[model samples]
Target: MSSTRFTDALTRLVDALPEPDDFPSTARNRELTARVGTWLGACFLLAFLTGVWSHLAQLPDPVLPLPTRPVWLYRVTQGVHVAAGTAAVPLLLVKLWSVFPQLFRRPPAVRRAQVLDAAERLSVLVLVSSASFQLVSGLANSAQWYPWSFSFRATHFAIGWVAMGALLVHVAVKLPVIRTAWLEPQGQPAQGTVSRRTVLGVTWAAAAVAVVTTAASGVPGVRRLSVLATRTGTGPGGIPVNKTAAAAGVARAAADPAFALVVAWGDTERRLSRADLEAMPQTTATLPIACVEGWSASGVWGGVRVADLVDLVGAPTGSAVLVESLQRVGASSRSRLPGNVAADREAILALTLAGEPLSLDHGYPCRVIAPNRPGALQTKWVSRLEVRP
Candidate 1:
């Protein structure tokens, strides 16, 4: 059809649709949307920064040198990442509800304005859909619920860029309107109907409650209050276990009497039994196991330093190592530790937690534990540590 014909048809359709004013309420004004969107946008921005740090932290070769000090960095960042996302849910819902009437509002009469209006709506669609997916998928990931076959980290990371891009476009397009609505006093509520203040107050309360109830999986202080938390930061040996020995299909291997930790550099190799590893000079470091699933807990890890193990194999300083687990499945069966990470004094091949032998579920004979690293990268049930040339 010609542009004119399409425009005429659209006008007729919009005319037949319910008018925005038909469902008017003081709570559903531009001011209300602006207020709620301010909070939603803040949440998204915070999640974006923390999420980027998380993705970079898990990379096999990070572009930048992630710090090894302030051991609780990842724990705090990932915790905030999940909490900000949780808080965004209610704010998004309220923002959308406040602007629901715009979905059926009549288009602009001027051709240029009409085109801009269409573009704005399209951007809004992308922003809302992507934001919703991020929140839902993030929540599912926190609960360890994966209904889809694709990698959650990869997909979530990619969509996050898309969502943020669309959000910028939306904000740019509506800046003038946002400024006006945000600065101006809210219009009074229709007599006998709820005020905009009440709506906003309730929405803020809901967001606060959401964050408090779910973010406890990562924050120890609020763990009790977070009854809805997925992981209570507690498991065998006082540290939560994401994958159990039996589930990883490594129970037999990890418990085998012949089990040995193979440390190799080039052609040189050293096989150490649990006794051998324990006999070596031991170091203790309190480090947090900060999982991507948004839970973390610190344990006093006691073991031989990774630097010592590499030195035994004749691996030089500033060398990276690939840690291999006994598990026969999953991408997490192996993880690469960079040069700086390996060199850090706080990095260890942990044999004990809280001064007790490591539990089978927590990597049995030995596991890799390092400060300021994601728990996934802290390879568990370690069988081999090969130094990279």
Candidate 2:
């Protein structure tokens, strides 16, 4: 069949189904849709910006070096990322419900209008599908649940661009309608149970509740209010661990009496036993293990400064280091520390937490704890540090 004829047939089939008129509701007006959409867009923008920063922060060679001061920068950004994403869940549901009837909208009779309608429908499909996947998968990641085989980080990052693009297109197409809804007052109230104001108020409340309940994953101050928090902010040394020695297959190796941290640069090498490292200068830094999964807790970490370790191997200041873990598996088994980060006095191969010897689950032998670094890159169960100038 010809393209026009095919379009007409599909339109007829869709029009035959229930129309928007059949699902009348006062909350289904353009004004309410616009308002909900505005809030949802703001959430998406915030999530996208922070997600980009997070992805960059995790890269072996970040596009830009992330900040290393204030100590709690990543903690705040990641916290906001998770909280905004969590809030989007409820806002998305309400936005979809407000415009659910649009799915049954009939194609226009004119070919020109029909083409525009088809384009709008396509944009909406992309927007909804991408937005839904991002929010749902993000929640799963925050909860540490992985039901899919694909890499969440890579997939989420790529789809984020698509979602943002679709969102921009949608806003451009609906700008006139949105502007009208925002500037003009609503006309006579529709004959329905809930008012537009009621729907909007309820949606805002739901979003707020969602954020408050889950924000403890990152913000410890809100832990009491966050009953639904993913992590309780309680673990070894008063900090949560994403991976334990048992889970990472490093339990026996970490406890071995002969265990030593090998620091190497070129032909020079030094193997320092646990006691030997303790004898060296100890520096304590209060740093937050700000997880990308959206939880964090601060602890007083004491250990040999990473700068000192590299210095033993004849490496000069501003030299980067590759930290290897006893972890035989997983992407976090080894991580690269940039030069500036390695030179930071606050960067240490921590041996003690809260003035107590490190727990096995908390990297007994040693772990890299640096300011403003993602928790995953902290390199727990540290076994080797290869310095590079």
Candidate 3:
């Protein structure tokens, strides 16, 4: 058989499948569903674009490989991903409610034709199921819980591709009807349409309010806006006490090295200890420590500007600075230095928390604070610094 003939045959086979017309009341429900779906699609597209851009920007040099991207970019994009996914929850629910009745519609024909129709419907079901799971699991992961054994990030990424593929197929199949619907008004009763508008307006307003409230709650002037307070516990630093127990708590055995300010000139290295650092002029700033896990705290940090530190040590510009943690072993632990230190100017070896010595869990002896990065990148337990070209 010719290729054209085979293609025509397949087209005919699919065209013979039964059509189901049990679409729900085209009243207010349909209009609301359309609006909600449009909003969600727009949000998802924005989030997708931002995420792709951030990932591309943080790509490491081809010569070196890292398990994750640089800390600052990763923190920003991860927050964006979580926030966008979280907002999609109610939008999706409203969309689903409007189209749910279509699930039980009866077909126009029976036999093999009906089987193909059912298969098409099944594809939609799979898309909805997988997308729903992805959203819920993502939300849970943001809350710092992993109920399933599988990695949420990896699984979520995989399922997102499947869902997008299925969605594209679905839209292709429905292009004609969708275009018609787009061109024509839903013709819902005026009162019903008004009610839907009210509902949607309220929903969007509430969502905006929630986001602003949550953000303000983290700041010192507006911390009251957030319902949850920052959590405190014995963290990685294990300071204000014994260094041995702190290392034991996080399951590491590392010596607590004295704080040092170092400068390298060609082959020779010059070093200044903690007393030398304290002898320099100091500046303090109050900032909030916001964790990706949805908890935040405010602290007053007193430290020399990282630029000042470099200058005091007489290090050259564009040099790499390594910030190590005394509370953990190896560079991979919570003590690990940030991946992109040269790009940031505000990175500091912090010495005080809320105007006092650092707390045990808060990196007691000394910690590195890089603004706008996740808590994970903020290494606790200061030990060493290596300046390099």
Q: How many pairs of residues collide in model 1?
A: 0
For model 2, how does the per-residue alpha-carbon lDDT over 231-281 read when each residue is reduced to its tens digit?
Answer: 788898999889889989999999999998899999898999999999999
For model 3, how does the per-residue alpha-carbon lDDT over 41-104 read when each residue is reduced to its tens digit?
Answer: 6656555555454334333222232322243454445545555665677677767766776665
Off by over 4 Å in 3: 1-30, 49-81, 106-123, 156-183, 189-195, 198-225, 228-276, 280-290, 294-300, 305-315, 327-340
Encode model 1's per-residue lDDT on 1-389: one tens digit a residue. Answer: 99999999998886788978887576677888888998899999999999999889989988787989899999999998999999999999999999888897888899999998898888999999999999999999988899999889899999999999998888888899899987775666667368888998999999989989888566656788898989777888799899999999999999998999899998998999999998999999999999988889989999999999889988897799999999867878999889999999999999999999999999989999999998889999999999997
| Best-to-worst TM-score order | 2, 1, 3
In candidate 2, stretches whose alpha carbon ends up further than 4 angstroms from where it belongs are 1-16, 188-190
Show the lowest summed lDDT stretch of 10 residues, model 2: 214-223
lDDT, each prediction: 0.90, 0.90, 0.56
Off by over 4 Å in 1: 1-16, 186-192
What TM-score goes with each of the models? 0.94, 0.95, 0.65
- In candidate 3, clashing pairs total 2
